[model samples]
Target: MADFGEILRSIGEFGLFQKVILFALCFPNAILPFQFASVFFIQSDPERHCNTDWILRADPDLSTGEQLNLTLPREEDGSFSRCRMFVPVDWNISDIREHRLNETTGCRDRWVYTNSLYEATIVTDFDLVCDQANLLEVAQTVLMAGILIGCLLFGPFAESFGRKRAAQVPVVVMVIFTATTGLCPNFYLYLASQFMVGIGYGGYRLNGVILATEWIGVSRRALGACGTQLFGAVGQIILASMIYFVRDWRLAQLLTAAPLAVVVVYIWFVPESARWLLDRGRTEEAKQLITKVAAINKRPVSDSLLEKIVVKETEKKGGIIILIQSSVLRKYFFTIILAWFSLNITYYCLSFNVGNFGLNIFLTQAMFGLTELPAHILCIWLLEALGRQVSIMSTLLIGGLLCLLILAVPQGNAAAVTALATSGRFFANWAGSICNVYVQELFPTSVRQTASGLGSIASRAGGLLAPLLNMLAMYHSSIPTIVFGSLTLISGALCILLPETRRRELPDSTDEAEANR
Candidate 1:
């Protein structure tokens, strides 16, 4: 058997062929932010009040101000009550003004939104306010649940099938269901579509990174992984721009799904993992791919060199059981799970609640998206310099501490809060991008997808919990921050146990991965 790394070197690693495939695989990452972070804009709470128009029946010429003043109750701050209106009365305007209606009731007809930042959103479209407001959170949770399910189903599927197939199927699913999400007639249908979209999202995310990483040399593996994330950051910026201009949620969603159609067509041209083919004893297929890659990269390969490619007969088929059965693998598996879970919770908590920072939503979101660009750039350097373990530990620790620091900032200091949150997001984004590369390096080829998938399940679980945790603000404003901060700190501390994988050969089997430390 020959070393695959040496074979990759001969074929011009990180050359034209690898660059094209990596770029093609990474393109979909740009769209994933539309799926993951669009919720913040699409579910935004617009300014609204009960339809006081019923009072118009009694006095048709009354001005907008007069109608609100007469028919709607005001909170202590003197804003018109969003969910309550006075009972309609038959009395004339003068009598009604003389003896104000004391009885209050929920909006009987519908809501009238005013000064809305968005032309429309799911909250407005579905009337998901007051009693139904919780449904908005449910929609996000449902999407995360779909992602979790996708990770579970696709992880093992990718392990059994091939990375190319796993990658292709999800793009189609995501495109279809994401468009369906826009066309959904009701909230239930919307939830269903979102769930399906999430499944596809999770599948494509896992496979695309693995496919790209498997194709690149170890020297450029960080580049390959972080490059995809850089595109993801660009996606976030694009999403912010899309939402700012196209405020209609349905139109924005349809537009978001449109680009993936291009991805679906182009992705089929990308090759399967040659490493995977050889590991599965498909030597002839691997040779053809290697030859093709060499030709594309303008490198020559000898038939003798190709003939040296062979599968190790000692390699065993792997599954989730392999992870559990081996103590070293088990330790890595659980630590990564916890780390992923914490990262997702902290990242999404800050991301989804971009509105609460008391700044312009569009600018704030754009700034948050911009923060990731430098964070990923820094992460590429950090992965190379500090090694994976220290990079992850330091980023998470610093990010978490920054989030906690917000608790000490005086309330109403929007600039201070925003500054702290953005800084934390910067580091959180750094840790997240590196973890994508780290997880792939930690496991062997046989169970890498499975391990990545299981880890994603934990991430989706954190995503699911993030919104629910944000709801904790209703009880105490500090609760969500404290919880998010504490989890991030704990996860950072746990990174102490992970082995540094810098400049290491990609492991091919369980024994190889165990021997990595």
Candidate 2:
């Protein structure tokens, strides 16, 4: 019997059928960046001060400046205290002026934000400032938790069910919850909706790559993997533009999610993986789909060629257990997990903290988004020229070094800091694009989606930590960078031990996967 790759060549490798599937799968990726990185705009911390409107009653004709001066205290930096207000008194405005009220307390009537880039964010709407600031981290953490859970749930699911269901269901869930996210009246509801969105994000992200790669020929697999990231990069750039104009978190959330509704309809029309179908003893269905693909690509194949396509089925089902049973697969799994963890934490830490670079947030974010285009484009070449192992190692190593170099930058040098961080992001993005293809290639087809999902779980765990690590900046500004950079370097060095998968056919069984070394 011929292997699936041989069958793919006989039908059409990068023909109309594969192109349609790739577009169907990759188009949603454009929306993913909005779901993944929207927090940067939605949770932005703007300048604020305590609301001291009680003083307005004291002097009805007082100017805005006079009201703030009388009602709020100044910080040591000479700025009005954001969370403190002078204790209100019934004394006349003249007496209040005489006393120059020194007594202060926490904001009694909420806070008033000024010079805000966003008209309203979760931070402003929920008053997530001062003592409540930690909630923003909590919200992001909740989203990450949902993503982790999705990975854990969907990894085995794709193996058990078809990849088509795994891909389609997530889009439906994302559309519902993302739209719901905009309607959330409180922080708690918003967190719930975001969690569901994260779940959808986690599942779709894993399945989309698996489905696309499984259908394409070995020669085009790099394009299948890296091309989706190109769309994701486009999504980020579009997100920056949307946030720049809309300036409202709810409206932006609604707009970003709108495209996925169309995806929900079209995704159902895309066919399931022929490889997956054959593995599950649905040979007739696989044969029919293969025939359909051949027809669409205008590459007619003989009936005998279709009949010869078969998958070697194992009595032992594929799952996490199979991974633990094979020592070689275990090594690949753990090493890739660490690599994924390092990449995600470093990438997201820089992403979520785009504002801290001291550059304009929109411009900085746009530049950051723009970096992914060339990164993925270069990744296609690097994967082909340097091979997967070298590409992963080199990008991670260089990205880490650039992150560490930020420590040498002077305190107020925004230009230098932004430059280094953006450069690090460029390499990190390249490493990320390679890792996406490399992880899929490292495991066998029976457990490919499962392994990818497991790897994503580690990635999401890293993402979960990113916000908490950003919290460490309070202890010291350099702490997060130190941790991100060190882990990245270690991950890069560890990739040296992994077997290269470039130019090799994907492993179809455990024995084939173990034999790659």
Candidate 3:
């Protein structure tokens, strides 16, 4: 049998190069989801209400006019007006389109340029837009649903196939599909691409977390895991800056997809996780990889120590079910589910609703991504110094409270309200990042991927609810803020139930973790 203590110590140790590769592998796609979430700014047709069914009803005149209204918001001469109705395809005439005059109609037929009004007044005299809003919503929901399945599927695959192969494959897949999302001819094609993108995203995210944790020392695992996400913040900033330059959603998506090329180059530089190899009984292979890693890290390898650290199967057998069947782990999983859900909802809500912020959509996105740099850096600093529970709880609580306060702000100062809301988002995101790091530490290697996967799925579920919340908020003034605030607050309370893992060594199995308590 392997000396579990020695193995734990060895697994905890990592050097600078390993850290860099892990960071690079995990960083580029950080804001890919942001691209999807941020699409609300450009995708929502505020003026057109052409129903897909109506267009398909074989009504050439209605379909023709619907396409024109959808195009108007993108045209240089077209203008946006607000909508008074709350129907799914109804475009708010004042808030939906650009502020350009319809010179052709002498600015008299704003309804013609507006999607919903164009359908209602000019086309069918009723809703005619092809139910595009529902189609888009279904697309987003299905994509997230795929994320749930993909994360679960990756656990066994990452364990069975080895972390390096599992981690690298998804990067290529994500790049291809994410890029294609920009070229989608219509809603159906976009939906399919989103599903594939979600799958790749789930696999890469889980594997990256596993690889980072496996490479680092237990003393530094939280730092590595949390810091890995900082690269995501960097990714967000890159995407944001790119969006500012590109403006168009299709081009912006292409820019987001471009990072896959850099990740491919890393195939030559990055190595498989040594811990994963040892655990899977590939001692010789593990040693060979370790030698290369040690050389790159400029560290000397200790053969005897390395042999002592190789994990060997013991008489006691545990499987995936143990993750949920174990008492303490069950509690840990449930609490994290709540926190993850809360985090996903608010994070996306804040990002997606930038259209209502009154700032230019591109500028708002750029600012939102930039805010994470400070938030993540601050999280990294505080997590190490203050411990996970306190840092996470405080950040969540403060952020949730701030979100609620935004509701009381007087109307018409959209810019000021948005600025405050963004500030609240900064703090909320920092807290949420802390939670991601904290939950990973709470589980053992046997179920580490499983736990992270479940948490991610839960987070995506929260994302599933976001668009609905957004639609509601669009109609009811205080719905989004109140709901998001309440969810965050509840998550903050649930966070208190989790045991703190700060400055403690990682437990190797569910048995060890439960026993430690």
Candidate 4:
């Protein structure tokens, strides 16, 4: 009997219908940044200080410049501080002049934004500054925490329910939550909305890729799966442009969510996976979809050909426990999770570090998104050249080592260090995309989405840690770089133990997965 991929080949692997659906699905891939990484702009503290209205009232005749100088405290670098101000003292000009040396305190009454970039954001609207600064951090933590649960929740659903149904449910919830997030009246509600978005993160990460992978043949599977990541990059560029035009986080967010809500209807247009249908014993539905595919590919298929389609064993195990008990698949499971966790951690750390790159945040952000294409292209080539396990290991090790290179450079060379850092980001981005393809190949159809969901949950654990690393400046500025770099290095080395799935067909069951051993 022909293997599943061979049956696909007989009909034509990648046809017009497959190409169109892949492009359609790429929209959700683009929406990823708006939820995950857009926090860079939304929660930006910006240059700010205590509202200076009281100072103006105290000295009615004083100029705007003089009032600012009197009320706001300047840091040692001569830039006005964002979080500090002087006491509302009734001091005279001599005492006020000496106020530069006076003791400082956190902002009182309310803070004012000194930044011209964003007119307003979730940060400024709710005063997420000074004592309240952790609101944004907490919001992110809640979101990651949601993702951690979402993966476990959604992974099993993809297996028990059909792929098309699993993919649809989270997106509808994502649309509602994301749209409402813009309208959230308080930071707590905003965090609540973020957690909802995180649920969709795991769902989309698992089912979306599997939906694409299960359809395409083995020869194009890596390209098919890794290629969606380029849309994620495209979304980043689109988001950067949206921020530039709108300059208001809520409005920009609404704009992003609105488009997604409109596109939810398109999800119905995509077909359920034929392979998944066959596995479920819905052979008639599978035959019809296969006939549709063959018709699109201009291949002739006889009724006998449809009847001859075979599954060696239709009965299968459920849940993640099957993976845990099986020694052969277990090695791939644990190592891939570590690599994904490190990838997510470092990618965001570099991405959020855009302000330090000496380039405008928009330009740096666009460049970061632009890197996704060539990086994915390089990953696809590497999958072909070095094979899957080697490619995964090489990208992970190279990315990790590059991150460590940042420590060797002197702090004075900001531009050079930024270049080195972006290079590290490039490799980490490549590694993360490749892992998406690699992990899907490591499991069988019965448990593919479940395994992928578990992987996403593990990776998002990195997402949870990434925000805390941003706060590392309070302890030591270099600590984040050192920590993130070390993680990737360790994850890369762990790749040595993962079996390669390069140019290999999707295993149909647990027994077939072990046969790769």
Q: Pick the candidate with the highest TM-score.
A: 2
Clashes of each: 0, 0, 35, 0
Deviation of model 2 at 29, angstroms:
0.9
TM-score of each: 0.95, 0.96, 0.80, 0.91
lDDT of every model, 2 decimals: 0.88, 0.88, 0.65, 0.80
**Which scores better on TM-score, 1 or 2?**
2
Query: Against the true structure, candidate 4 has what lDDT?
Result: 0.80
| lDDT of the structure predicted as candidate 1 | 0.88
Better TM-score candidate (1, 4): 1
Cα lDDT tens digits, model 4, 1-517, are 4467877887877888678767777678888787754476753556677786776555678887787787777889997777788777766666666645467777777777764577787778888777787777776678877777777788888788888877888788788888888889887788888888888877776788788878888888887888788888788888777787777777776887877886688887789988888888777788888889889888887767776875445745765788888888888788889899999899867876676666677777777788777898887788888888888788888888888898889877877787788789889989888888988888888878777888888888887888788778679878999999999999999888888788788998888888885
RMSD of each: 2.0, 1.8, 8.5, 3.2
> Which residue runs of candidate 4 sit more than 4 Å off their true CA positions?
42-45, 52-62, 65-106, 310-313
lDDT of 2 at 301: 92
* Runs of candidate 2 exceeding 4 Å displacement: 36-38, 42-45, 90-102, 310-312
lDDT of 2 at 210: 87
Model 2 RMSD, rounded to 1 decimal:
1.8
Please report, as a residue range, the 10-residue window in candidate 3 with the lowest summed lDDT.
117-126
lDDT (tens digit, per residue) of candidate 2 on 336-383: 999999989999899888888889988998998898899999898889
How far residue 302's Cα lies from its native spot in candidate 2, in Å, is 0.8
